[model samples]
Target: MNKKEDSPSSLDLIWGVSEIAKMIGRTERQTYHMIQSGNLPMVKQVGERYVASRSKLIAFFIEDAA
Candidate 1:
């Protein structure tokens, strides 16, 4: 099995794109575009899903607000 598969499925420190979008009041497509445009930090791909760091997302909002 690959190392990724060997890793734990439970993520304690990250959020998926949909979850982050809901928190930030943006659509999933918008979030994906942000990632594509480098407006938002890149995400780590897990299987077929993209995951973002919760802390990073919070920081992004804080920076944007500043």
Candidate 2:
């Protein structure tokens, strides 16, 4: 397998909204609004894209569920 397959799917680093949205099953626009409206924590807009930590996204949901 390649490097990406060898490791986890970058779930612990900062990435743009498009990629982040794919991970969380949300549209890019929805993710943008989520960040803008402060619904999802630890997310922010940087230039034309919103950025967030994938691990934090996972943690937020897990925390919310509990």
Candidate 3:
């Protein structure tokens, strides 16, 4: 299989709750709570899972920091 076909153009384009949690050094459960509280922006839905846009998430933190 071609590597490009197997993975995304950019790994950060879409991140699952576990990936986001790992990036922020938080647990998956905590990340879910943040999503439920509307603190974090949720991305497109793929089936039953919620993924987040990397750029949007970064922007969210940047705006939050301001």
Candidate 4:
């Protein structure tokens, strides 16, 4: 087995719309609007819900800050 395989990855952790909103201090409704407006990237969709990875969201903030 590889050492990498033994460790958990933050990138593998997924977050839903509400979690993300709480992280960024926004309301769920506003988060949804951000997704629809192309401000935030949606990594996956399940029925009516949106999902995003923590790493991707951090990258978004980094890029936006630059």
Candidate 5:
């Protein structure tokens, strides 16, 4: 087995705004705007991509819900 495969890259743990939006029940447009404007937590632009970590977003929203 490959070491890189065994330990996933940070990029592998994140999802684009569209996917993240679906997971959080928000519209893709709104999610994209929010993330782009830095209104959402745990989202950032890496090179040409906007991405957020699945676990971090889950924790953030859960804490927010509480």
Candidate 6:
């Protein structure tokens, strides 16, 4: 098997809007607004769900704290 097959999928690192909100302690609506307003990193939508990159979210918080 290849390393890619053994590793988790990219989707695994992608978080839903609600999950992102919980991580940042914000409301889902607020999170959506942030995304809409371009205040937050862009996400990839999968069906009805919005998926944000975990690394981007972490970097955003780290930068905010700086």
Encode model 3's per-residue lDDT on 11-66: one tens digit a residue.
55665788878766689999889878887855555687778867678788878889
TM-score of each: 0.66, 0.69, 0.67, 0.68, 0.73, 0.69
Candidate-wise lDDT, in order: 0.73, 0.79, 0.74, 0.75, 0.76, 0.78
**Cα lDDT of model 1 overall?**
0.73
lDDT of 5 by residue, 1-66 (tens): 767766755544666677878877899899888786876867877787777777778888888889
RMSD of each: 4.9, 4.0, 3.0, 3.8, 2.3, 3.0
Off by over 4 Å in 5: 8-12
Candidates arranged by lDDT, highest first:
2, 6, 5, 4, 3, 1
Candidate 1 residues lying further than 4 Å off, grouped into runs, are: 1-12
Error of 1 at 49 (Å): 0.8
Model 5: lowest-lDDT 10 consecutive positions:
8-17
In model 4, where do residues sit more than 4 Å from their true spots?
1-11
Screening candidate 2 with a backbone cut-off below 3 angstroms (N, C-alpha, C), the clashing residue pairs are none
Best by lDDT: 2
- Model 3: colliding residue pairs: none
Off by over 4 Å in 2: 1-11
Candidate 3 displacement at residue 25 in angstroms: 2.7
Order of candidates by TM-score, top first?
Answer: 5, 6, 2, 4, 3, 1
lDDT of 1 by residue, 17-62 (tens): 7876776789999988877788876467688777876666778789
RMSD of 5: 2.3
Tell me the tens digit of each residue's lDDT in model 6 across 1-66: 688756665644656888988877899999889878888855767898888777777888899899
Model 2 shows how many backbone clashes? 0
lDDT of 6: 0.78
lDDT of 5: 0.76
